[model samples]
Each structure stands twice: as C-alpha cells, then as structure tokens.
Target chain A: MTTDDPSFSPPSFVPFERLCLIGLGLIGSSLGHATRRAGAAREIIGVDRHQPNGQKALEIGFIDTLAPDLETAVTGADLVILATPVGAFDAIGKAIGPHLSPGAIVSDVGSVKGVALDVLTPHLPAHIHLLPAHPVAGTENSGPEAGFASLFDGRWSILTPPEGSDPDALSRLTAFWEQLGATVEIMTAAHHDLVLAITSHIPHLIAYNIVGTAADLETVTKSEVIKFSAGGFRDFTRIAASDPDMWRDIFLSNKDAVLEMLGRFSEDLSVLQRAIRDGDGATLHDLFSRTRAIRREIIEAGQDAAAADFGRRPPSRADDSKF
Target chain B: MTTDDPSFSPPSFVPFERLCLIGLGLIGSSLGHATRRAGAAREIIGVDRHQPNGQKALEIGFIDTLAPDLETAVTGADLVILATPVGAFDAIGKAIGPHLSPGAIVSDVGSVKGVALDVLTPHLPAHIHLLPAHPVAGTENSGPEAGFASLFDGRWSILTPPEGSDPDALSRLTAFWEQLGATVEIMTAAHHDLVLAITSHIPHLIAYNIVGTAADLETVTKSEVIKFSAGGFRDFTRIAASDPDMWRDIFLSNKDAVLEMLGRFSEDLSVLQRAIRDGDGATLHDLFSRTRAIRREIIEAGQDAAAADFGRRPPSRADDSKF
Candidate 1:
C-alpha cells in the first residue's frame, strides 16, 4: 500500500497467456501498466477505436501489441476485457463475440455490473466464459498517458459472475485481479449495482450536479467561484471533472439504482435544509458528528489516506516567502 | 506556492504591538503560526476556554502567552481576532468588549460574516474598530497540533468592514493578512455570506448529507461503502470530516443564504434526476462537460492544484510488489 515508495515492486505472476484490453483510456491503460508490472499476462494486446490512445499506450510500453480493431485484439487472446464506457459494451460485445477463442474468459471494467451482464451475455459465445467486473478505482483524468501501474493497489475489484459460472474461469479471473494488486469481491450483479448506486453512482451525480449548480449561479460570478474554490467547493470539482461520456453512461445504464439513491439523498438533504432553516442546531450537530465517524472508518479501512486534506501539499514557510 | 518545500521563509513585519487570538483550533492555531512566522505581532496572546487547547498552543510556541479568559487575553492587545465558532462570538465579544483598549481593531475568522457583525457590533465600544474577515483556507484537521504557518499562503482573506469604519484600522488589518501570505479582498458582510454559502457552506452540507445517507442505507453495508469508496464517495468524506460544532454554527448563522443555495441545488438536482430517469444521456453529458470546464478554470486561476486526484499519491510498482 506504500505506493509512493520507489524501491517496492509486486511479485510477478502470469495468469493469462494473452490478455486483450479494448479501450486505452485511464482504466484500460492503467490495467495494461499494472498487468505488465505484476506479470499478470504474458502479452497485453491493446485495442482502442481512437488510434492515438493505442499509440500512446504503445509508447508507454505497457502493451505488447496494438491492435487496430476489436476482432484483431481478441483473435488469439485467452482473456478479453472490454474496458470502454459501459454504453459501448453492447456493440463491442457483439462485434468481438464471434472472434473470441473457445474457453476464453470475457470480462469488463465498467462502473455498473448489472448492465454489463444484461448487454454482454446475449452476444458472447457459450464456449467463452463470461464474467463481469468493476474495479472501484479511478482518477479524474483520462487518456493512456494518465495511467500508472499502482492505480489498483489496495483497491477492490468486484466480480459479478452469473449463476453456474465455470469455477476455474472465476478463479483465474480473481487471480488475475489479485496479481494486479486488487482485492477481489464476488457478488450478484444486482447487488453490485445497488451497492455502487449509493457508493459510486450517486456520489458522481451529486458532484456533477453541485458543480453545475455553482456554474449557473447568477449571484456568484464564475471567476469568483473558481478563485475561492479552495473552500469545500473545490473538492467536489475533482470528481466532477471526470470523463463526461463515461459518467453519462453510468447514470443512464444504472438508472433505477441511481434514481433510488438520488431520491434518498434528496430526502435527507431536505431534512437538513429544514433544520438549517429552522436553526435546529441539534439536528445539524448530530448528523455532522455521525458523518465524521464514517470518515474515520473510511481512512481506517484504507479506502482513503488518513492525512488531512487528502494530504494535499500544504503551504510551507518556503511557499509563503515567495508571496 | 510550493508549500511543501522547506528552507524557505518570508520577510517579517509587525502590524500590532500585541495580538490576541481567541480560539485554539485549526484556524486559530494556524493564525498563530502564520502570524508568528510573519512577525505580525510583537507579542502573541492566545485564549481558549478549553484549558488543554490553550496550553497546547503555548507548548507549540505559536503564542508568547496563553490566557484562560477572553477578558485577560484582550486586556492590552492592539489587535484581537475572534477565532471561535460563530455561535461563541456573541458571548466572547460581550466578555472582551469592556476590557479592550481604545483604538484596538477587533476582527474574526468566522465563516459567516453577517453574524459576526451582528453579534460583535453591539458589544464593541464606539472607539473600537470591528472588522470581520475570513481566510478561505484550511485542512480538515483540528486542534493546535494541526497548526501550519503556510495554511493561508496564496489564499484569499476577505475583509468585511462596516460602513464608515476607521480607514487606518482597515488598512492595517489588510496589511496584516497580506503579510501572512494572503491576498486581501474587501466586500460587504452580506456579499461574503452569500458567496461563501455556495462556495463553502452548502458544499459541506451536501457532503455531510450524502455521507449520512450512505451510512443509513439498509441494502448496502457500511463496510461495502467504505471498501469501494475510491469510486467517488471518499471525496465527500474528507469535507464531511471537518469540525462538527464549527459547521453547525456556520449553517445556523448563515441560514438564509445557505437555504437559498440549497433550494437552487435541489432544483437543479431534480432536473438531473429526471434526465437520468428518462435516459437523457445528452442532458447528463452536457452538464458533466460544462462542470469539467469550471474545474479547468479553477486550476488555471491557481486556486487548486492541476495534478490528478488533487495530487494524491498513486499506487506504484513498489506498492504493488507488496501485495
């Protein structure tokens, strides 16, 4: 978990002879880098519809071969991962199904698990083992150059294998994520979607919504908001800056769960709103105190750094001297 | 501002013969550190109703003297800053008003500006200057041990001077903040409250609200939420961990503006919810894309670090090797 240490490296183990990663953005490229570092795959064959992303991954040296198309990428691969936005899964699944080798394990790194199963299962060949997964990790940045091998270190990769899945295939996929430095959790796709709805999907929606609200404020100038953002507003912006298309797909694909959670969030917010309006300090204090404990749990759980302000670089004597 | 770099110190100037700060938490203690570093006061007097907090501030060497009571702390100080939560301002202002020296300039570092003026103006004598200011900076941590001199470096310090205030007092307070490594902006008390309601107050509210909602979910275990927080929930928890009492006072003191902004936020969120429920990808994508631009503007304005994940430490090869 000491990801910043230069002298550390994970043990190398190959779980797949050929791994085809379709999509060369942040998650895809990061998987390539981590797989190479962990020796999780003998060869990482990368494919992106965007040629420059593939070229950048090649330059980054995580991918052994850059394929121009999905069919070419999956032709001889034993493990094929669709790493694109969840919205793109249906077409990619259909296009690459006929080309996948028998006994190959097909998986995904999308944010929503249920949709992956709903869209991918129908198109995949029965000969190929279909397993879906979501690595609950990412930064706000995109593109191949944004990737790093340690992105998954100490993170969770939740797998949603259908009922009666091949145990060997499930074990191998779990081992693959483990080699890449992620702890694996197995759950039903429905459960995974519901859990992520509260944890991931809704948080992203709220971040995006708050940022949008800040932007449309007629009373507050956009420049003023930007300049004074070191206030709590800036924290929301980090996640709001995440890839638009990907999140759009997440919100649309996981519509029911997201709406359910959003309703609960708004309901809770209204209670706080009433409390603030009524100057109900006790209610506000109780909720704020309860939330503080959760943050401690998160840091203790190693889901976040224990350092204050996410260990952001604090102004030092040296920094002040310049002003 | 390169605040993490050591071996740097700023030129020092003293604006007050004796300065008293009336709280020993994150902002107050940081003020002591930054003030001492800038040589802003010939003698620093610290006051905290909490005996341990006062002793810790003295032990940290930021204060030349620790006073157990506000009256004793402000006895002969030329400048006094009320650094306690907004709720305490009324009592402290009342206690210290008769004890303050003539021509002394009194200020505060409270988040709600209008409340500071409302609570302090009545207690303060005609000869004393009541200038309220807020330094828009801090980490989530609290207490004297969390003090850092560079906390305000490159941040804004907004001064809300009541009408026909002493020009010399205002100028001196502005210079004191500048010397402590902050840029000074003068605005009305009401404007400061409204701007910050969006920039700071409501963001904290939404963060606290969401974390509470997550903790209350029956379908999703708290452990699952914590383990998978990297997806986005963890970002909110950072702000949610901020001092509970301080935030409780902020919401109560700035009720109108916070409520107004919250109403707008809810209206906008309702639109997003509808869009998601109706499968309007374009609506979600457009807002997400627009918000990303604001984040870029914030970075370009030098209000936030441009580094991905707020420059959070990413997993590296060595980190993976451990797993």
Candidate 2:
C-alpha cells in the first residue's frame, strides 16, 4: 500500500485485537493517534512510567485506556509496542515477557535496530514474534501533547525481522504502519543500524556538537549567537533540541555504527577545514554544489517539504492563538 | 522602530533620493521590495549581469526601473548597493568606480564584511563612502523571484564601517536598513566576521559537509538517505541547498574566521566522538540538553518563531496556489 494514496485502506484483516503501547511520548502517542484514526486496532492501551503522561494520552483520546503497569497492559494484548528510548528495551522486554499472551507480536519504534534485537530478543518468549521497526519521522517535540496523527505521512517505516522470524507476524506489522500512512520497507537489523547511524544518529550528534561549540565560544556570546541565529545557526538548534534521553540512549546502544559514521564525518570535516584554511575556493564550491543535489532528491522523494524556507511562513491569526 | 510592529513606518526621513541595487538575486531583489514597500528610497534602479533577473525584478514591481549597465545604474544614484557575491566585489567596484557620482554612499549586503572592505576599498574613489553591511536574514531559495519584502523583519542588520569614515554616511546607511525593518547594530569588520563565523559560516560548512558525507557512504545508498532524511538529515539539507556560488564566496572571503571556528568545531566534535566511543551517555545528554536552551533563547528573542516544527504547518488551500 502506498502512503501517498489517501484513499487506501488497510486489508480487511485486523493486525491486532488489542494493541498495548508501552510508552506515551511523541512516537508512542503518535502511533496511538494513527491507529485509532485508521481503526487499525479494536482497543488501544497506553502505559508509561510517568503516570501523568498515560493520563494525558487517555485524555487526548489517542488511547482507549491507560494501564498503570506492564503486566496489566500486556495481559490480553495481541500486539505490544515498546515505544521508549532504546536503553529501556531490556527492562521492558523482561517485564512484559511473562505477561504477554501466547502468540502476541512484539515490536518497537526505536532509532537503532541492531541494539534492539540484542537487548530484546533474549528476554522475549520464543512463542511470540519480535519485529523491530523504525519509523523515519518525528519532530523535536516530546510527550503526548507534542504528537499528531500525521507525523508518519509520506515517511518510511523500516522493519527489521531477525532470521527465522514468523512471516505472518512481519507482514501484519508492515500492514499496520502502511495503514497509518507510511511506506514500509524491510531490511536487516545490522544494515538498518548503519544506515541510521549516518542519516539520523550522526547528524544529530553533529548538530548537538556544533551548538555546544558555538555556545562555548569566548568570542561570540550566547546572546549574540541567539540574536544572529537567523544566519543559519537556528536550523541546527531545532535538531539539537530533540529529546536528550532518547538521543543519549541511541548513541550508547548503537555505539559501533555511531563511532564509524562519526569517524567518517570527522575525516570529511578535516578536509573541509584544511580547504578553508588554505583558501581552496574550488573545493568548497564543488562540495557545496554537490550537496545541493541531495537536498533536491530528498524533496522529490517526499521526505521533506519543497517549500523555500522549510515552509516556515509568517504566523497567521490561527498561529497567534496557538501561542 | 520595532520590527515586530507590522504597521511600522519609517521615521519620516528618506535615506536616499535614488537607490541602485547591483546584482538582483535573493538579497538584492528583497532589498528592492523592502525599500519600495517602506518608501525608504525615492527611486530604485535594478542592475544584474544576467539581464533576465533585472527584467524580472522590474516586472515584479520591486524596482522602479532597470539599468542596462553598472555605469548607468550608479550614474545618478545617491546610494549604490552592491548585492553580488563577495568574490565579484573587486570587479564590480572597478566597473562602477569611474561612473559613481561624488558623495554617493556605497554599501553591500555581502556575508563577509572584512573582505568587502579589503576588495571594494581599493577600487572605489575616495569621495564615495564605503559602508559595509550584512543583513543577517535569508532563506535557502535564490534568484530575483525568490525575494520578499518582509524577509528582514525582526532580523539584525550589522554594519561594519571602517575607522575614520564619515559619521553622517554611516548613520544614513544605518537608517536605511532600520527603515527597511531591521534592528541595526554597529561593530568592527573583524568582530563581525568572527561572530558570523560561529553563527553562520561554520554551521553552513558543517551542514554542507554532513550532507556530502551522508551522500557518499558506500553502505547506504542515496535512495535510502533521501527516504530516511526526515529522521534528522533533512534539516541539514535545507541549509545545504542554499546558493552554491554565494556560499563558495563566503568560505573563501571569510577564510580566517571560518577556519578558526571550524577548528573549534572539529575539536568539540572529536571530544564528543570520544565520549560516544566510550559509551559516555552523560556527556551526550548534557550537551544535547544545553543546546535545547539555546533554541529556547532564540525563540524568546524573536529570532525564530516558537511554532512547533519550525512553524511548518501542512499546506492549507492558501499555500496550494503558491506553487
């Protein structure tokens, strides 16, 4: 099913009779909204370590009910989605393992897939299926209030099922994401880790690092940086403002891939540094020009809006009310 | 003169009898629209080496008329603004020098102020005032058609006037930018370069470099990169898609400061890289959390709109026809 086709509906078969979401933050709450909108689940159960977030999710109408504990949440659920930071997967898997009903499908929306398999597989019961999924979409915002149903529209959702996984469970999860307005792809957990290392993890690391570097500069005060941020520094701040705990977990879990991509990035940056120091206009121009093409491809692929300024129009009357 | 006041009018003093804008691209054309909207200039003349751009600027009503050549553009103009790439300043200054009317105040909207002084000062006649300015605002879009009148609203316009320059001319230029809807500040050319190095130039360089690094990864194909960009890499792509020629000139012109800031960035990144390699979650979390505050400061200072997702709402019917 194509995500671009707004009229497309999920196959008549329901993926899960009862879906339990283990976290109620941005991704989890968004999933709840999408599934409820698509009628993809008969009942949606929300659980969060922070009780207030689960309450918020229930009040927001993304979930039909809120479970105070994992055992209660997963007791009769046919599908259990672990939607927290990657670092929490181990504990979550162990906690939900015994409570999960027989033949229940387990999935997650973590940024790193390889580590998800390593941490979750050992704890999960063999009778249940574990399909690791990464929905390549999000805003920097966090918590239930920050999520909207359309977050995954026209975005990719990659599912990485370990070898010897049940085919029926895998397709059911894929159908669930597609119904929620995402094009789905399947890949190995290892490859997903490497791809996201460069595309997501490393880019986030660089954004955080540069913002830190700019803030620490003795020559340019923090006020100056903020005042002049329209000159391009503000763009980095958006990505850097992402959930700190989530990113911290991603880096630690995907340590090897993150380090490899970081190494490549540093090497490439050093070359740029040298060119700048040596007054290499041609090198800078060529590199800058080539990167422009990638931006075009991304816009064409529908991964980004084609708007001139990332579609950041001046506030209208409605926007003022939001503030 | 508050930029936030949409109904603000320039304080009754017209800064220039006639304003000539050389190189009618994004910056130049935007200046034309702004000056015309604010009635800051009595007559605005557009000049571009690419004749179509001049014609487009006139058709768009951003300028009163189009001048066929640099000589004609500067002949009767009291204010001549060089809005070309910094690299072209030497040739432009030389071409327009002999024709510039005495007492004409010459200024530029180049990103690199120090180089603007170095390149344009030698070629211009001593009678004409050279007041270099950098308006710290723009989108990634280029060309005359991409210009908009409100681009400078709530943004900073930094002036880097040379020492011993006529105070009257400096103040006139400052008043012009202020009337065009920017808050004005004065600083040395050296200091401006250093400040922008961290805030604008280095951020752009890192953006360009990271996009390039992602595109060239052998394991991750370009298609995957594009598909998954929304995860984080797409933010960098917006900045990277900026006009290549302008960025090339900025890197070459502001080599010293860019290199220095880049050095600091590389060092900071190296430390982060080490932390990640050693699985240092605290460092990553601390840095990521600190940067979030900078984003807050920028939004509070009115440098960025506080709308979630950089104010990118899904296109309503009003935005459809914009394409």
Docking class of 1: medium
For model 1 chain A, the run of ten residues with the poorest summed lDDT: A314-323
Best-matching candidate per lDDT: 1
Each predicted model: what fraction of the native A–B Cα contacts (within 8 Å) does it retain? 0.74, 0.75
Clashing pairs in 2: none
> What is the clash count for each candidate, in the order shown?
6, 0
Tell me the interface RMSD of model 1, in angstroms: 3.7
**Runs in model 2 with CA error above 4 Å?**
A1-11, A313-323, B1-12, B310-323
lDDT of 2 at A251: 91
Give the per-residue Cα lDDT of candidate 1 at B90. Answer: 86
